[model samples]
Target: MPKPRGRGTSAEPRRTVKASSGSARARRQGKAGERAGAKAGPPAALRDRQERAPASSRARPRKAKAATSLAETAVVKRPAAPEKRAAAERPAAPKGRPPRARAGDQASAAPPKRRPRNAKAKSGADDAELSPPRPPELDWDDTPSESAEEVLAQRWAARGEELFQQLEGHGAALHEYRADLKEGRFVWIAPNGRVSAEASARLLCSWSCATSVLVMAWADPLVSGAEIERIDGMPAEQDGVDEQGAWQIAMRAADACNAAYLYRVSSPQAWYFLALDGLTFSPKRTSFHPGAPVGLVLRAIGEVREAIASRAEPADVVRDRISALSDSLFHQARYAYRDTDWVARLDRTGSCLSHLAKRIPRAGFSAIAAGQRIDEWLERELALELINALSLIEDEWSLFG
Candidate 1:
């Protein structure tokens, strides 16, 4: 501004002057502080106080702070004792139990005290007294106790007695056969003393003669008064006029009767009567006119009659009889004339007999009640089938005649 001083020279001189003034002011302040310190030398009390104090306290507060921090770090780094840690971690005791002694304090430990049994019972009684009383209940002291096996045996014995009574009744009916025969009936004697007219005297005689021949094939018995007459009355031998001829005539007589009448009169009981009559009357004469086919049929009919007469006979026996009857019918059918309507009728009758025989074996007889129904059905069906087969035989005989 004054003369546009030289750029580098003027700026350097001003800097130099400022630096010198700052150095001089600094040195003066330093001297003044030193002098003031020398003039106020340490107070006597402060000097004594300083001497009495610890040498460590005389050091910087930062150094003392660092020393204290090192001590705290050592304390923090140290681990707590196991016993103290366990004590701190242990759970508080429940209100009901006393405080438990430590496991390590075995000397202080004792067995836990228990209330006496009588005291416990008294407490229970007290509690019951506080509660409402229960209602009275029935006592079963008077009831008789039975063991399982004993009860089972008793039940079986009772059932056996009942079954025996039923069997006796059935046997009584069978035993009445003699009386029925005396009244001119084979199965049952009606209250009115009327007998089925389906079995005429001549037809019965012919059937008796045929049955006698069958019986004689198996066993020979002594001939009697009526037996002699029946044998003498038999016709002379001729073509198509033998035991088979007698059977055909008897079958024709059966066909002439009502279906119900035929079924009733041609029952197993009636067959039994015929067998008994032949055995008692013409056993010797029957042996003379024996035929294998006729004997087989008669034997099967006898078995069926025996099964009906005796309730104790097992179902297998009845089944065997039915099977035999079917077999006999089949064999008889083979003798039918070929290319005739009778052949078809014989086949149908044989099929029905075979079906009935098979059905009898399949029928269940586990219980008496169930067996009774099955037996009834079998009896009815057997009577109907016998009637049908005999009717077919009669028709075949008529066609041939």
Candidate 2:
């Protein structure tokens, strides 16, 4: 400011020289202090602190220094005891995190502590928490399999078998008699005319008595008065006995007898008979005669006797008989009655028999049970009439002397 300083001149040259000398002296003193410190070693307080420190803490610098030396020498050194103890004492890192490694101690580090295998929760407990509960087991027993009707039928069949065994004991004689009658070898002459042998008359009388017993046992109590009168008034010569009239007469007598027999049979027995009839008997077109009813009665008696002798269940047998009776009646009615009033009566009787034949065992014994037995006197009188008729025959030549 006093006078502009010249470009190459200084106002304090001597001062600048003095500052240079001072800086050189300061540098020389610092060097001498460093050399003295090297000879004397560290201060007493610092050395004492280093000696008192834990081995784990004290080995840190030594390890660093060794690492530097190894780098310089291109060789590796084993970790010191202090470094190993420090690594062993360190806590294991938490799961999902890596342990922090020292700057130059990566190789000296201990293996990461494995989580204790037994320390984890039990596998069963974990599964219980994650899965749904199990279902209970089922019991298949105690379940009903059959319908009520089926159970009833089975019981009825059992009962029927028991009854059949009881009835079989009385059938042997009847079957033998029926076989004898079927031969049709006997002949008859008018009463007071040329007579057959006494033995033949006795045999014929016996057959007539057997046939009457069966017919009386089987006769329906509901027989129409008109039908009874017609039968009672019939002429011995059969003047009106054409195919149609013969059918009507035979069917009327047979159906009445069949109805009575069915009434006497048990429900189970009846049902069994019906099933048998369905299997064995079907409708057929055929001729009818005065002797047709007798033939049918004999056939039925033979079967009944056979069944009784064999101790066979009667349900099937009875059912078949009823069906046969009904079917026979039907064929006769169709052949004999066309659209006449007798057709209706025949149809009704046939329907009654058909119902009996088709009945199941749902009602037990009450379904087909018979009412009271026929009056004893009436039965006796009918038996007497049959015997008398057999003794006289139209041609009384067959009568015993």
Candidate 3:
């Protein structure tokens, strides 16, 4: 038992075995770590990420709950509707006279006047010859004095309402006629049936032309330049009396009508009541995606990518620039979650962004393969995605604060 060399020297054998086993385990662990490092690449610092890093990499779970709590507290609240603002604080009356009738009141209003006998008789007449009929000759004692402006306004509105009604009537008649034809019931057709339809159609066309001119006369100059050009350069009909001059006169008349309407009705009231209803009302539902804005920028970047992908050699500079822009947008949208301290929420959004990036090119390429322009489809897809995203944001705004 005197310090045996090969045998146990008290705890010597146990210690030796333990040391050997520990070294073997340490070697195995080092090899495993090396392999893992090779597979995973180098560890990335969260703060050291480039401005345009892939969305997923950038969107990480917050390490501390304090950051999230602060974010929840930091939400910017939408301003409350004012308790009361002076008429001055209120937005200016939509640039014109108020409407003569509210939208809902149209059905109950007095019947509009029919086409003037004078207009029917003249067919085409000079403005001087087509002077409007004088307001019913009234005794000063019996009637309140009306300014020329008021008189003209009243007459124009009456005519506009009449025209709108006539258009509606004609549309209904056309539908009826088509139905009858479909049913094979051509019996007992009146001689004047077709004539009447033709006349109404002509009148409707004329009214539309006149209304367009009238609308432009009062149109806000802020309307797009293209619309202005379309108005100014409208094509002239051969038989219509000095078509250019007639349009000009009609435009001026329209301004007067618009002034009267603006003075009477609110913007929302006018849009709902007069103009849109005449055009027909078929409500369509539109939707926008939550991640669309970033999608568009990504698609545009993809175009750059495809360009880079093409050619005999890669254009690294161009590719890098485009990639940077795409990445920047992706990063911006992803980083927004961080501002809100929604690390968990952002993780999902980042995944969506990455998915969108991948899908854009796939969609674009698919379109190209299907005999469509890839760029065209890519841009269009991007637009749709943006619309979807905006819609989501709007919904969220409503849902949250």
Clash count, one per candidate: 0, 13, 24
- Model 3 agreement with the true structure over 1-401: per-residue lDDT tens digits: 56666554565556433344444544554445445434555423221222233455223233222342232233223234565445447566665787466677988888888998888657656754777867797566956589655665566567667644664664533321111111111111122333222110000012112112223312323222212122344342223334344433443434533422111111100110111111222212111113223332333334343443443222333323333443444454453223344444434444444454444443345657876434423354554554465345434434433
Order the candidates by lDDT, highest first: 1, 2, 3
All models: lDDT?
Answer: 0.40, 0.36, 0.36
Task: Find the number of clashing residue pairs for candidate 3.
Answer: 24
| TM-scores for the candidates | 0.20, 0.17, 0.16
lDDT (0-100) at residue 190 of candidate 2?
20
How well does candidate 3 score on lDDT at residue 212? 20
Candidate 3 segments whose C-alpha is farther than 4 A from its true place: 1-144, 172-401
lDDT of 2 by residue, 310-387 (tens): 443334444465566566557645643444455665566557656655542323455437432332122334334423
Give the deviation of candidate 2 from the true structure as CA RMSD. Answer: 23.5
User: Given candidate 1, what's the lDDT at residue 231?
Assistant: 36
Cα-based lDDT at residue 14, candidate 2:
35
Give the top-scoring candidate (TM-score). Answer: 1
Candidate 3 at 360: error in angstroms?
A: 35
